[model samples]
Target: MSGRQEQINLDTLEPQQLAQVKKQLDEELEHLTNSFAQLHAAQNKFKDCLRCVKSRSGAPEDIGTGFLVEKKLKSAEKFYESKVEELGNNLKDLEVIVQRKQTNARTIEEVLRQKILASQGQDQQQA
Candidate 1:
């Protein structure tokens, strides 16, 4: 997986299977967390490079490959900027997914709690 969200039919899963799915979601969330950190570091590196490029004087070779290198560097800066935007969007999406998963897990927990409470009530009444 590209650390992207998968479509799960939560209604079709048994409680045990839902727990398994939650575990898998947790693992995926951990992976995405690391990926986010790495992406942020890479974004910082790209920003630094862009700053360095912008601060430099004219190319050393007044009319040759130095100029070409400078041009390519500018092009690379644009590319990196686009990549950063894309990563930011991905991060946002991942956050939304994490939130949804948490909500679902909480809902499941509440349901389980209610079931336990009901079972206890029944036992007390029988006793």
Candidate 2:
């Protein structure tokens, strides 16, 4: 990378432009949040099913039926575990995106603050 600093004046954007960017970030964050909630719900459902399966009564009268049920439940548990892992990976990706957008918003805010202070200094100087 070159040692020369690249000048990026975020203040060059109009307030409307900043607002639009903020809105986009907010909408994306909201969507990701909803997705996480849905994923959590799915994970919870799987956990609940697993718990229910584990708590089943081991009665000798239903040995054959119990074996079939246990086999199916084990298969379902494996499937749900894989799905949970996939959802977790997706959740991690969304979190990273959200973090990046937050950083961008903060940087823009700092730039706007600087612009305001600079304008104030100019006004004071003109006085």
- In model 1, what are the clashing residue pairs, if there are any? none
TM, every model:
0.65, 0.69
Query: What is candidate 2's lDDT per residue for 20-41, written digit by digit as tens?
Result: 7667767876886787788778
The lDDT for every candidate, in the order shown, is: 0.69, 0.70
Query: After best superposition, candidate 2 residue 126: deviation in angstroms?
Result: 3.0
As a whole number from 0 to 100, the lDDT of residue 65 in candidate 1 is: 46
Clashes of each: 0, 0
Per-residue CA lDDT of candidate 1, range 1-127, in tens? 3456567665556656666766776776677677767877877787777677677666544456446666766777788778777777776777776677667767666555565676689999999
- How big is the positional error of residue 99 in model 1, measured in Å on the Cα after superposition? 1.5
* For model 2, the run of ten residues with the poorest summed lDDT: 1-10
